[model samples]
Target: MQSTLERASHWLALLCKIVAGIALLALLGVTIADVSTRYLYRLTEGAIALRVIGSVELVSYLMLLSLLAAMAANVEKSQVVVEAFSHGLSPNLKNRLHGVYLLGFAALGLVLFIGLLDSATAAARHGEVTQDLRLPMGPIYYMAAVLSLLLGLRSLIHALLSAVFGAEGEVSHGE
Candidate 1:
């Protein structure tokens, strides 16, 4: 069961990384296009009207998605650590402490997932839409909720692994 879960988590992290990459690429593309169009319009002195409508809305949504999609992978690999504080601790103790820290991230993810779900429901009920693009807000909230749930599950799994298996490939700080 543990191995299966680990495999699943690995695949989940891969999927999330791919999604984050694509979203970031799209965000970059949108920003470039928006800026290019504006620059061209100015350079042409009103002869070219190539402004991208609702670019701000697109960028904001894409940024949110990219960040959220990266959360599952980041939960395991990109945690902030004060190595100075844990430098003297034994491996076992460090692993246990890391497990607790991961649990905090799990709790945060779970809470955000629940809140996003509620927001999705409310948006659907009220027919809420984006200000500029008029895109339905419910689906976006649903996607965010799914990503948050993945983060929570991945964090829980890592927490268990750290607590029970003594941190995987952990590096000593002062070594």
Candidate 2:
């Protein structure tokens, strides 16, 4: 069971990376296209108008936000340090500290997750959009909210598992 869960988490993490990469690629393409078109227009029309280009830019910006969220999910995993006193501390204390860290992460994630959902709903109802595109911003907000919620759930699950099993290296006290 544990192995399965670990495998699933690893796959999900990989999926996030792939998604981030795709979003970044799309952003780059849009940016290049927008710039080239504007440059050509400026040479011919005597001034650059970025209306359509700006719409693309808005999408690009949203993509950037998505990419950052994905990257954070992955980078934060390894960067999460619970080792305030790992080497010199007893095994049990170290495990407890790790559990505490996991719980903290879960709490943070929960807060962000709930707030994001509400924000997304409000944005949708308001028909919010970027000034250039006038495209609905609700979808982007929704995606972000979902991603954050998943991250939170993942952290919470990890916390529970660690608490039950102790650190990876030590024998679990209960079982």
Candidate 3:
């Protein structure tokens, strides 16, 4: 009973959640390894010589990816509502207002997507790389831009559903 767009959005949200989970796991693993290495090094009086090079840079990238990837799934679930102000409003009006609120988020996501794409283009043009790992930054920026685009699209869909159809209940929680 769902449109293709709705089904696609659901699938995309699922994919994004999976990506977020993987990135989080990777981040945790890196942090644990780095901490263990540092502890062992200190305990061995620097004889072990084990250190995670570029660990900080890696962690930062992973964190950003995870956060961005989660945005699509969190859009509807994370909205703030003022019950006192809206309690008296009719349900139809509330749905329209919520749609407008979601539109704002869609706008924000679109802006970020544009900015990230520009940054990715510039990074690719300049052959930029991460400081510690020397990994190409263009790909990372492009990935982030894609995620931002997904967020925007998802918000737009929710906005349409709410405003046009007055759909109620949560669509997804990224679970």
lDDT of 3 by residue, 80-163 (tens): 789999989988888778878889889988999999999999999999999999999999999999999988988887787777
Which ten residues in a row are the worst by lDDT in model 1? Answer: 166-175
Candidate 2: lDDT of 73? 51
Best by TM-score: 3
Runs of candidate 2 with Cα error greater than 4 angstroms are 35-52, 55-60, 71-76, 80-84, 90-96, 167-175
Model 2 residue pairs with clashes: none
Q: Report lDDT (Cα) of residue 44, candidate 3.
A: 97
2 or 3, which is superior by TM-score? Answer: 3
lDDT of each: 0.84, 0.62, 0.86
For each candidate, give its TM-score against the true structure.
Answer: 0.92, 0.70, 0.93
Clashes of each: 0, 0, 0
Q: Distance (Å) between predicted and true CA of 30, model 2? A: 2.6
Ranking by lDDT: 3, 1, 2
Off by over 4 Å in 1: 169-175
